[model samples]
Target chain A: MTYCVGIKLNAGLVFLSDSRTNAGVDHISTFRKMIVYERPGDRFMVLLTAGNLSIAQSVREILQTEQLKDPGGGEPVSIWNARSMFDATRVLGQAVRHVYERDAEALRHSGVEFNVSMIFGGQIRGEGMRLFSVYSAGNFIEATAETPFFQIGESKYGKPVLDRLVRPETSLDEAAKCALVSMDSTMKSNLSVGPPLDLAVYEVDRFASEKLVCIDMSNPYYRMVHSSWGQKLREAFDSVPDPVWQGATDLPLATESCQHKPLRKIGRPEERLI
Target chain B: MTYCVGIKLNAGLVFLSDSRTNAGVDHISTFRKMIVYERPGDRFMVLLTAGNLSIAQSVREILQTEQLKDPGGGEPVSIWNARSMFDATRVLGQAVRHVYERDAEALRHSGVEFNVSMIFGGQIRGEGMRLFSVYSAGNFIEATAETPFFQIGESKYGKPVLDRLVRPETSLDEAAKCALVSMDSTMKSNLSVGPPLDLAVYEVDRFASEKLVCIDMSNPYYRMVHSSWGQKLREAFDSVPDPVWQGATDLPLATESCQHKPLRKIGRPEERLI
Candidate 1:
């Protein structure tokens, strides 16, 4: 299992992924799930994956040299030479399909689904930054203003924070911070998503990134963020007033202010359960 | 989909459930998913349901008079006459099995799994309070001191808070508050789990509960909790320092104090993707 997040903001793209892989509780290992592709002033892209290790590894290996035929019939387009991010992602989808063609049938025979998902986001020289969520079927969907982020695997535990904080207007640094916080919550609740995290923060149109780091448990910044966020969250919870059961309290639980009827109780065996 | 949570504490037991039911996005309706069976001085029990609405509805209807054969060869035991909460839950499991026996095959023909899950918790006068998570197969597991609560349906979005805050020592009001906050988070992240929530709080050794409330969006107390919790959570998030990308800042994200190496980049197309 894994937890990986990719956020598309006005400033740039933020990618974060946990580095834990498990076949079962006993067969746990660390595997980096991020790939960075940069052509200096031409294109800068990052791919984050979650699912079967073998398939992801195969797709990553194939994607480097994988090419898609151009509809205009000029030349084969690879991630390196693609004119647009959309075409670059089409090459990635092809790589995924290539892996599936090789492995899906054998995996199905073993009763294992050929499951893999990826987050691919970057900018090409002539176009704006594009973010996509690619599926096990080699199909993909692009992110838009209404939905500015994509998360794959162990996503729900960390989703509330992303829902509350992320928007198209979020800054690059702020989105990175939010992504880390989301990862922190996920790691706290799910042991399968353990550390040494990979983080990449790209500034819009930079065509390169310098803010990439590997964060282990001992990292001072992650440690501080983990402890401070926990303590602060506890404080925030404590600050909320508890429901006052009865009497004239500050915030009464059983007030007539609600338009709905209070819950009905079944005090006898003959009463309706619903 | 639904969201229901039940917590057992030293002070009492707390149960909360939402009232939204959906077969598909177009087929949405409101249906209460909680049931209370209280015999005042003798026993008090709450049943919170999630999963297939028909299955839960059948279980509730059958549970009224459903009986389990006594292994000791006496009269059959029904929830009304069961001496222990364990025996009472066994009767509940039998009720689920009864429904399954009648409906599971037909439902499977329609490609709907006979899916249902329930959180049943309460006190029988002779022994201590008990909490059980009952599965679709009519088997159940009790809550322990380490895992003092159970949640069913759309659970992950709200689980981190429970993992952080719940313990055997948590008070009844605090647990109830926590349950509402948990439900609030679920509702915020998922539209399928919505308002008009049912909440019940029971005190230790008190066979009946006076603290039951139906909270809708218009409820003043719930309104305060919803707004205050959101505000405080944002403030807490703001209080945590953002990652220090570079320089000798107080919380540097890429500090040399950590033992792990920074992420390596692939600068050329020929570099290894692994």
Candidate 2:
């Protein structure tokens, strides 16, 4: 299992991925899941992957060399030389399809789905930053202002925070922090998603970024955030008054005069709520 | 789809369930998932079901009269006559198996799995309160101090808070509050789980409880909690500092200078990370 998130914000883009991988609990291992492609002042891209490691690695390898045919039959389109992020993503889709063509049948015979999903986002020299979630089928969906983020692999546990916190206008650094918090929630509930995170932040239209980091359990800032978030969350919970079953005006959760009845009881076979 | 959670604390037991049921997103309706069986002052039990509504409803119908043979050749043990909470849970499991025996084959023929899970817990006259998670296979597991809660259906989105907040010593009201908060998170992220929730709270050894309520969108207390929790959570998130990439302080999430090279860039099809 894995947990990876990519957010395209007005300020920039934020990418975070956990490093744990396991065929089974006993075989758990750490493998970095974030990859950055940077040409300093020219272009910058980040890829976060989840699903079968072999499939993802193959796609990554092929992605470098994968090409899409040009409509005019001239130079083929590839990620590095693509004029727009849309064309770059098309190249990525082609890479995924290439791997599928090579491995899907064999994997099916072995009872393994050719499962792989990725978040691919970045900027090229001319266009605005774009982020997309690529599916195993080689199709993809781009993020928009109304839905400015994408998450892949074991996504639910980490989703609530993103649902509440992320916005198209959020700062790149804040979105990074939100992603880590989201990852933290996931790590707390799921053993399969562990530490040694890879994170990258890109400023929109900059064509390059320098904010990249690798975080392990020993990282000082993460430790502070983890402990402080927990403590502060507890304080917040404590501040909320407990439900009072019967009350006049004090925020009681349940009152005697409410229209809804308590659940109906059945002590005998003949009893039913309906 | 559904979301139901049962928690056992030193103060008592808490059970909460959402009322949404859907065959697909287009076929959604409200069907209450909680059933309480109490011979007030004698025995008090709450059953929260998730998964196939038909199967669970049948189990509940059969459960009213379902009986387990006594090893000692005494009278058959029905939930109403069970001397221990354990025996009542066993009868509930038996009810599940009965439903499976009757419908599993037919459901499978139509491509539906015999999917159903339940959280059953309460106090029977003579024993301490007990909580259980019953499976589709008619097997069950009891909650203990180390893991004093069980959630069924669409559970992951709401799990992080339970992991962070629940403890053996948590108060009944607090646990109930936590359960509602967890349910709120699930509902926010999943369309399948929705409002008009049923909640029941039991005090240890009481054999009955008065704290039961059906909370709909208009319910004042739930309205307060839904708004307050979301608002407070946002405030907490805002209070946390955003990531600072080039800072001097050693933050746990700070970018580390590493011997490992940055991810390889691809300027053309020939460029590869390796």
Candidate 3:
């Protein structure tokens, strides 16, 4: 299992991935999942992957040189020379499909589905930023304003915070902070997602990023965020008044303002109904 | 889909379940997942089910009359007559197996797995509180001091809060509050789990529980929890400092205190290697 998130906000893009990979609980290993592609003044992109490591590594290997013939009889398109992020992702999708065509049948015979997902996001020199979640079938969906982030692998445990905090108007640093908090929550709940996180922050139209780093357990900012978030969350929870069992008017838990029916307990154990 | 959680604390027990049931996104309906069996002054138990609605409903129906033979050949043990909460749960397991025998094969022919899971917990007059997570195979595991709660169906989104809060010494109301908060989180992230919700709180050695209620979107308490939690969680998140882009020693995101290899960005896009 893995947890990787890619955020596309008005300010820029944020990508974070944990390095833990496991074939089984006992076969755990560390495999960095984020790969950055930068052409200084031209383009900057990040790819975060999860699922079968073999397939993802294959897709990554093939993606750099994978090409799609332009239907208009122009030069073949590859990630390096694609005019737009959309065409670059098409090259990526083709790479995934190539791997699927090669491995899916053999993997199916061994009872493993050809499962892999990748978060691909960044900017080309000519366009605004784009973020996409590429699926197992090599197809993809671009992130929109309403859903400005995409997460792959062990995603749910970390989702509520992102759902509540991330938006098109969020600042780049804040979105990065939210991603780390999300990852921290995931690491706390899931053992398969672990330390030595790869984080990259890209600023809009810069076509380059300098805010890239590897975070181990001891990273000062992460350690601070992890401890403080837990403590402050507890404080936040404590701040909510406990349920007033007697339905007090001021802070009632069971108020008459509720129009729905209240639950009824079965008063008898032997009571049976089909 | 459903979301149900059962918590066992030294103070008592807490059970909360959402009522949404969906065959598919378009086929969603409301079917309460909690059932209570109370022989007041003798025993009080709540069963929360998730997975195939047919299997769970059948298991619930069979549980009413399902009996396990005693090794000594005394009257067959039923939930009502069981000597302990563990024994009652065993009877419940047998009921699940009975349903599997009758339906699993036929269901499998149509490509549906015999999927069902349950959280059963409460107290009998002679014993302390007990909590068990029962599986479709008619097997179960009890919650322990270190891990004092079990969640079924759409569990991941709600798990982080529970992991942070519930402990043996947590008060009954606090556990109930925690359970509600957990459910609120799940609802926020998952469309399949929604209101109305069933909640019951049992005190230690009580053999009965009076704190049972159904909460809907309009319920004052749930409304308060739903709104307050999002606001407070956002406020909690804001309290944390944003990442320092300049690598300031005071609050740096990329401090030299870290002992992990930093990720190296691919400086050239045309470089390709397998």
The positional error of residue A103 in candidate 3, measured at the CA in angstroms, is 1.6
lDDT of each: 0.89, 0.87, 0.90
| Model 3, residue A211: C-alpha shift (Å) | 0.9
Q: Please identify model 2 stretches exceeding 4 Å from their true place.
A: A256-262, B250-252, B255-268
Which parts of model 3 have CA positions greater than 4 angstroms off? A255-261, A267-270, B269-274
lDDT of 2 by residue, B1-274 (tens): 9999999999999999999999888999989899988897889999999999999889988898899999899999998989998889899999999999999999999999999999999988778899999999989999999999999999999999999999999998889889988999899999999978999999997887778888887777787888999888888888887766665755535555443344444554556566
TM-score winner: 3
Report the C-alpha lDDT of model 1 over B92-155, residue by residue, as the tens digit. Answer: 8988998989998999999999999999999999999999999999999999999999999999
DockQ, all candidates in order? 0.68, 0.62, 0.68
Question: Which numbered prediction scores highest in lDDT against the true structure?
Answer: 3
Docking quality of model 3: it rates as: medium
Identify the runs in model 1 with alpha carbons over 4 angstroms from their true place.
A246-250, A257-261, B257-261
Q: Rank by lDDT, highest first.
A: 3, 1, 2
**After TM-score superposition, what is the CA distance of residue B53 in candidate 3 from its true location, in Å?**
0.8
For every candidate in turn, the CA RMSD to the true structure comes to 1.7, 1.7, 1.4
> Scoring only the second chain, what is candidate 2's TM-score?
0.95
Clashing residue pairs in candidate 3 (N, C-alpha, C atoms within 3 angstroms):
none
> On residues B88-120, what C-alpha lDDT tens digit does candidate 3 reach at each position?
999999999999999999999999999999999
Docking class of 2: medium
